[model samples]
Target: MNEVLVSEKLVVRVPCAVIEYNGKVLAGQRSAALSFPLKWEFPGGKAEKNESDEDALYREIKEELDVDIEIIQKLPVTSKDQGWREIILVPFICRLKTLQITLTEHEQILWLGPEELSSLDWTEADLNVIENYYEYLSVKK
Candidate 1:
């Protein structure tokens, strides 16, 4: 399992994922080189040391998706064990001004509607939020 060492205390990373919706949510397929190869996940990454959540979100999206995002709202944080320390993930709902996304780290990307999202084989960490978002969409419709 991947572990991050912080100041003599091993601290797992806090990754923030963004749900970018324009009638659909964006999901990225992990590259073959990555641990969760081919599994779909929301676009984001680890929060840098001393960086704020919003800044980390922006930096991650720009690095991974190559697009700027406007954070709509932050969702609840979730924790999962990665065989090491527990990883805390914070998900955000965001709006993408440009639909054009250039994937730098992922193999493929999909823009999925709520129903489609529920049917997909998502990463374990993303499953709960995916279900929540699907429910939210069902209610909205």
Candidate 2:
């Protein structure tokens, strides 16, 4: 895992995932109860202590989406200062190993192609990372 500290307000290190299936990438709509509520984002969560990025991502996906993923490639890590807290978001290219659609935190899920990527109302941090991802990752179709 890549670690960086800008201030004492560091909040968490999140391992975000980009799961590609068929020709589209997976996105989830966050529940309105959470921060940045109702915005779209790549599925992932905070990394636990002593866990590698890959391991944290795998565990997060299984817990959040109820699916197993195989990490194909790890992309760059982006850091953001959210006033009271700072976040280090790490993104990855991954393949889904299960087809089940399960969610405990998100309201819904969508599989969108590259052309439809920018049309969603994504969280600022997610959109920033998505921009970086689009430079190298393309929709399969």
Highest TM-score against the true fold, candidate: 2
Q: Residues 1-141, candidate 1, lDDT per residue (tens digit)?
A: 999875543555555565656677888888989877888888788888898888998899889888888887777777777665666777888898666788899998888876688677778888877766666556658
Off by over 4 Å in 2: 1-7, 138-141
**Which clashing pairs does model 2 show?**
none
Query: Per-residue error at 32 for model 2, in Å?
Result: 1.0
Local accuracy by lDDT, each model: 0.77, 0.88
* Model 1: ten consecutive residues of lowest lDDT: 6-15
Candidate 2 TM-score versus the reference: 0.89
Candidate 2 C-alpha lDDT tens digits along 1-141 = 999876567689999998989979999999999989999999999999899878899989998999999898878788888887888899998898898968988999999996798999998888888887787665432
